[model samples]
Target chain A: MDFKKKQTEANLKPGDRTVPERKIPVPHRDISERAQEMIAAPYNVFIDWNLNPPTKDDWSKIVTKVSESSAPAVNKLIEDLGLTVEQLQIGGVKCYRLTPENIPENHRKQLVIVAHGGAYVYAPGIGSVREAAMFAAFGGYTTISVDYSLSYENPFPGAIEDMIDVWRAILTEYDPRSVAMTGTSAGGGLIMATILKIKELGLGMPAAIAPSSPWADLTETGDSYKTNEWLDNILVSYSGYLGLAAKLYANGNDLSHPLLSPINGNLEGFPPTILTSGTRDLFLSNTVRSHRKLRRARVPAQLHIYEGISHSQLSFDPDLPETREAYGEIAAFFDQYLIW
Target chain B: MDFKKKQTEANLKPGDRTVPERKIPVPHRDISERAQEMIAAPYNVFIDWNLNPPTKDDWSKIVTKVSESSAPAVNKLIEDLGLTVEQLQIGGVKCYRLTPENIPENHRKQLVIVAHGGAYVYAPGIGSVREAAMFAAFGGYTTISVDYSLSYENPFPGAIEDMIDVWRAILTEYDPRSVAMTGTSAGGGLIMATILKIKELGLGMPAAIAPSSPWADLTETGDSYKTNEWLDNILVSYSGYLGLAAKLYANGNDLSHPLLSPINGNLEGFPPTILTSGTRDLFLSNTVRSHRKLRRARVPAQLHIYEGISHSQLSFDPDLPETREAYGEIAAFFDQYLIW
Candidate 1:
């Protein structure tokens, strides 16, 4: 409480010390009601969260549990947005195609490929298609959601290969210039890796890509991984299942492999990218770092960080203004870049 | 700790409720030592901060005290950067001209006009010239530091008019297209208002403007005002001196007036802009909102947010990498837009 001493200490160069402790309280004003509630909710307060599933089968059950739980919201979103969803087999892989009631003239030729996020192992089927449906309903573009291979049985190259296969299949029907891709969290990370794989395979890049709250760095190397731990309501810490999932996805691969963590990849000639994350999002640093990487490569990139939401929470409820604003930024970015 | 019930609650619509509680701890990993130290510092833990100065004279005294205290560090920065500072009278107002040790040939014609940050009432003289020196030293461009009229004696139109006076004077000798402007905090806010006034007065826009952590909204309207209150080491809350300074600067005028808060101004055709803030910066939402406004107006804008920093704390030490990166972004943005 000695003001003068603390001020002097602040002016001094920081030295090594034991971990400093302080408690942060939820902001009661300025932010929206939904944001406040999301931040205030202890969504990741599981005491058993540190325990990883004992086997791959256990991980599959966890994925199923999450997918089943998230089904109602995806159904609600589809109903509210007046979108039709259908299962498809594309490139010999499972996929979901979402179509809006009317395709506007300008976007008639455009196709959006989406990679859905549930870390790397969860959110199969409809859960994996939620973001694609949102983009389709909001942007009026026919969207394809790739149900990439989960890490429980297939890892690393598996998800990346599934995405590339879908991209190649889409390219046969749609022009590459008219194609755009986007996803959230692990899906965000996967799409980035997919683009890298596409580049490696000499498959052209999409017109634009939006990686929202990407878990771009599998290694806990971003500033937010630490700063936003316990603060971000979801993905509360890399120490939880997120860490276990990162290892599961790596499956003995190097965490720093550009394919595993695209931020470390050669980003030169990457497509125009628009990134989204909230102030309290655990992947904010990931998004920020990715934006810098794109900018460093001289690629046109736009970063939109929402006020106080956490980890893809903007997509949590389609009714939130922040949700609309987040999508609007992405849609605008795409409209500017994506070819008809 | 009941994950199942909490998950259900998270899915429900957020309704009216009592203020929720949370306790955020400092991240021990993934961020720079300096960032960790700055975030962990108890610099703003002043029990007496809620009290404001009773009179304009008292406020002036506080300003002088702050300037005097900050002089040592500013002096160190000048010496470290090998920058030479001189007093100048431009447009019949006091200012400082900062010259780097060697002005590179390409930058000889480039002028960077800097407005320093101090909440509009503090950091007069050399303290006010620190940011200009840093920009000049790092960017290798000759810079002018505006010693604008303070709110204690002159408010509202006073600072804006002074900036315009200086701009008009600079325009007589230097091509506006060859010039760039940068500032932090109030300086950030002031430069923005100045640009709006420049547009109103038929003066051509500068090549680019970099507003680092601008205090663009005077109404305490941004989400970070509450969310980053105590978390941001500097400008801990709006209820303290910052709130008083806001009122003093507004001088009883509506805080929402376009010139008072330039985010509300017509930013159409505004020059290329680069904005910088930090994850923990109180002015982060201000920067984010300003970027959105500029983007909405179709202005070329880029936003760079540091991992874990507070309001204008990047300017505190020129030795810090974040400081270098922040200025580098501004410099690169200016270089891309400014005519050689």
Candidate 2:
């Protein structure tokens, strides 16, 4: 339908009254055409047209697809770095780990624990671990990537318990305030839950946390869950989140319980946190809501929302200026809060 | 009051049961010994203390004392910078202007128009104007400090009219997206009012806003008015905020009107905002409430509460790292959103 017809049908004021007609037209030739096309299309259609899904498959297919696709890349990256793999016992669970020997001795003193993401369904792989090792080396910090139990195998408390043990080991070895925890997606949720657990256990909180595109609320009540339904480019719909993994992780437990959905957790005294997400990411609301909760709890929190980027794009394209800038900011936050 | 005595009198559980005895070892240190001493003093000594009016003499003296003491410091730091100033006709009122040259060119070319703080009773002076110039220089934005009519001389719409005129001039000169408005105390309220006026006038929205230690609600519904009481070193007590100046600024206006209180303002579509204040600051509640309102409105907003810092300390002690960091973050935010 035409603009006027849609306005009339909706009983809304004319377009001129709502949004003034641009006196100076859009500069780019193609942009104007695109703008016109967008204005002509129904709002939902426009949203869907702009939607960019990173993975085009059902949840049942996701694990196998990711495992197969990421394996070769992970293997090649790990081989190129000549990293050594090791096993560590954490909270009575054996976790896989990797340490790069090329890292300078000075850098090996400061530890960075990487909690891999996949809504708690996947293990820390060669792809993410190699990147974490590279970042830790470059940033002059010793890094360990946790290969915790996934929801498909053990679920819920298994992952949480593994993380707590890893954290406890770190604390026993180094000052708690000097430690920095980070992750993306479900790993982000783990970071938040880890901090919450530390506080509840009366352990000293970490100096800082950086969770990118975090799946904060497994329950999915964020307005963006509904508002950015098709506009998001990654994690296409909340169904992959709230519908599938949430049930899998819950193991028939209450989804709204703070332990399952950290967004519902009382955020009174978490450490300084930095949350990053792209506007086109399906988990945008997860990051935004988490940031809001952290702020309300009087925790020093910083949130950076990139306008047009997609989820996990930063990790995939670390050289992009936007990605580098986002990581740089997160690193800077860690630098300020994480002091050994 | 001793915990054991209070618990016994109230027929409540003993403190040892609720709180571990190990935590109660330093009970006496927690009590205010100075307060106890004061209360135990002779009746004659107490009478003599009350007779002295706490060294300031009276309310008028208190206001004058603060204004006079703060002036020279403001002037020495700000006015000496030689910022470019102009007198502009705004809303049929004369408004002082600090031009682009006053700010560092490399920072950003955005404009920041400021309304000075004086509880709407005092006129803009060398101190506030200088502070604005310094802020522009440090913040890397062209700043126009409004010398709006004050309440003692001109009431209600008089200051609002001047602000509206200055905003009109800014709109005419720059793209609204390239401009941000800010203020401290009463000026903070004016910034909120200016936003409402601009919205009502159908002008484009600004990119961002930062209101520091704003006296948002003249009616003083903020719990700090009672709770902070003597603990707040500045604004000494709520009476100074609610009794005289609040009544004067209102000029019979509704106390809860968002324009007057602005803590109650409808915050839809306003620019991304950052608010800063100190825990002990008198305007803590104003900042908190404004933050809550902005969040409720779904406007991207941030609030930073600095521990132990008093009212306007960030501006006052710009040389301090914390102050510079806080302002630097604000400048960075404006850089991100405000495209020149």
Highest-TM-score candidate: 1
- Each prediction's DockQ against the real complex: 0.21, 0.02
lDDT of 1 by residue, B1-340 (tens): 6653453354333322112233344543335676676666664432233448989999998788878877888888888888888898999889999899898777889999998887788878888888888889889999999999999999888999899999999989999999998899999999999999999889978999999999898888776775565556677668778889889999999998989888888999889999999877888889887887787688988888877677888887777766877787788788899888
Tens-digit per-residue lDDT, B33-150, candidate 2: 3322321222122011112222212534644555676667755654455456666666566565675454555445577878887677643444456547656757766677777776
Candidate 1, residues A1-340, lDDT tens digits: the string is 6543443354333332112333344544335677676766664532233458989999998778878988888888888899988999999889988999998888899988999887788888888777888889888999999988999989888999888788888888888888899999998898898888888899877999999999889998876775565557677667778889899989999998999999889999889999999877889889988887787688888888776677888766777766777788888888998888
Show the colliding residue pairs in model 1.
A24-B24
Note the residue pairs that clash in candidate 2: A52-A233, B91-B165
Docking class of 2: incorrect
Instruction: Give the C-alpha lDDT of model 2.
Output: 0.60
Model 2 regions lying over 4 Å from their true place:
A1-5, A8-65, A79-87, A90-92, A96-108, A123-131, A240-242, B1-93, B96-112, B115-340
Give the candidate number with the greatest DockQ: 1
Give me the displacement of residue A191 in model 1, in angstroms. Answer: 1.5
- For residues A1-340, write the lDDT of model 2, one tens digit per residue: 8543332233222111111111111111112233222212222221222122333244335555656667687666655655666656654555545666665544345567778776676443454464465455345556677877777667787788888988887777888777788888888888888877887899877778888888777875653454333333344456434356677778889887777778888888888898876533567657766775676567788866543344554654333455555666676678787664
